[model samples]
Target: MTRASYVRRTSEIEHYFDRTALAAWKRLTGDQPVSGIRATVRQGREAMRQTLAGWLPRDLTGWRILDAGCGSGVLSLELMARGADVVGIDLSAQMVSFARQRAAELQTQRSVPTAGRVDFRSGDMLDPRLGRFDAVVAMDVLIHYAPEDARSVLEQFAERTRRGLLFTLAPSSHLLRAMLMIGKVFPRSDRAPAIYPTDPEQLAGQLVAQQHMSGWRVGRSQRISVGFYTSQAVEVVRS
Candidate 1:
């Protein structure tokens, strides 16, 4: 796709999420009753969170985290709870609004320190001017990208992160890829610009070739379904 079409696709996805933020929130991580796919997704999200917790610095008292495609700031809230400051960005204004509101509510209820609070903005991650952070996170955000674009994104992420990056992608396994394609038939999944399965090993190669980083430690995050995997990359020499 041309740059113009790629941008248009992202804009269209933003509009879709803006319209469905509330319902999507309920399905993804909201407190409402859930079953089937919603429950399955939640379980997967929790597992990813656990993986991230282990990947990040154990003591984040003064650390800064960048949450790209933050959605509803769910992970941002978790980071704040651990005393890490967060700057979150989402393409949809509606999603940003909800994220900011929820961040405020969580801060008030949890009585977390101000230094470790989170703030959100509406912006595209592909915007080149976004600054760096101690660690960068883009969870389920790359799901919309085609393969080449995803690789480009990884290189960009390498520059934007100081210590590490955390993300999830649908793997390139044929069975998993087919399941994802079938899932797209449902409107809930179809709203995304596209569902492109990725190979962690190949992506790691891209990172190594393009970003000159070969320290990624990848793992399977979507066990219930053969659909997704997560990757965590940090300097092997970090103290």
Candidate 2:
């Protein structure tokens, strides 16, 4: 897509969520943080759960968790439900507002601590002031950055996470590229996602040597469908 088209697409997405954020919380589940009302909520929730399973420890009772690019606070809300202390950040102000409202609503109705455990903030993915956490998560977020910037973002992720890190990205492969090109040409869907694609081999090389997080692994999560593959990766800090 052309630069102007990309900008327009991003703006359109932001505005869409800005209008629809609160409408999402009327139906709340433990999975609703990542499971906002889209044309496809079920698929989104499953994809988020699969991606988050990597950095989520079975016993994260008091562990501080960070949800980067926390859209509508779906995954952050889910983490709270599961007993982790969560801090979720998203680029969209409307999303942050919706997430906070959802938490309040859930807390009021459920009378549960799950709602109290989460904190949501508004910030850019590229901001430097974001703090550290025991585990950091960025589902379907990093792939938005250019491939050359992906390594830096990974390094920042490692730096911000004290124990572990998790994220998802679109695969850079000939087949996927061809598909993206064809999709853009025909306009099969207006909800075309911007992907910063990177080859798995290149990611492995960057993770192993450049960032020095050598034990990372990348694997596909439960596929919501054919086009949107949720992939998970984890890198344990050596310290």
Candidate 3:
């Protein structure tokens, strides 16, 4: 994708999460009760987060991790509990605010001994000012981008990621296409930003072929599917 298109999409996503869907997202990520469909989505997200966590070292002491697109800081908190010093960045200011509040609450209530900490910020995840990380975890962050844009974003991440990059993408499938069609029926104002489903095999092939990603190799992967949520987790490790 062209830089202008990428920027436009990014801005759209920021507006959706930061303004249009902020309240609903806060509830979904919190302990509040939601509808059955949202319940399944919540469950699926939790499972996916656990799956990503499992891919990391059991003990993350001294690790410097980046939680890209950290919504309300659930994954960031989990990583912190595992002894990782995490930097959680998101495009939504409201989301980052919520994350900071949540983190503060957790730290006040818990006395567990761990080497984990988190600095939540609202900004572009690809910002160079954020500096390098031992690893980066971006859950459901790239699903809005076209395939080529997604790969380009990954290549950018690869440059600063010393060890590995873990992220989720909307997988291309019949069910996913059907879901997209169904989503189109909703009013544009009521619907979330469009999700671009990407073929995992094609994405892997592109990663392998990209000269910029030559130092990295595709690693483990898994797909998580629930009533309304389906995402593929992919790992890329430095060679």
Highest lDDT: which candidate? 3
Residue-level lDDT for 37 in candidate 2: 41
lDDT of each residue in 1-239, candidate 3, tens digit only: 77789888889899999989999999999999999889999999999999999999989998999999999999998899889999999999999999999888878887534567889999989899999999999999999887888988888888898999999999898877787889999987687888888887679768867776777888898999988888999998988
* Candidate ranking (lDDT, best to worst): 3, 1, 2
Write model 2 residue lDDT over 80-133, tens digit each, in one string: 877888888876786788779877887889845563388888765545576667
Report model 3's TM-score to 2 decimal places: 0.94
Candidate 3 root-mean-square deviation in Å? 1.6
Every model: Cα RMSD to truth: 4.0, 5.6, 1.6
How much RMSD separates candidate 1 from the native structure?
A: 4.0
What's model 3's overall lDDT?
Answer: 0.89
Order the candidates by TM-score, highest first — what do you get?
3, 1, 2
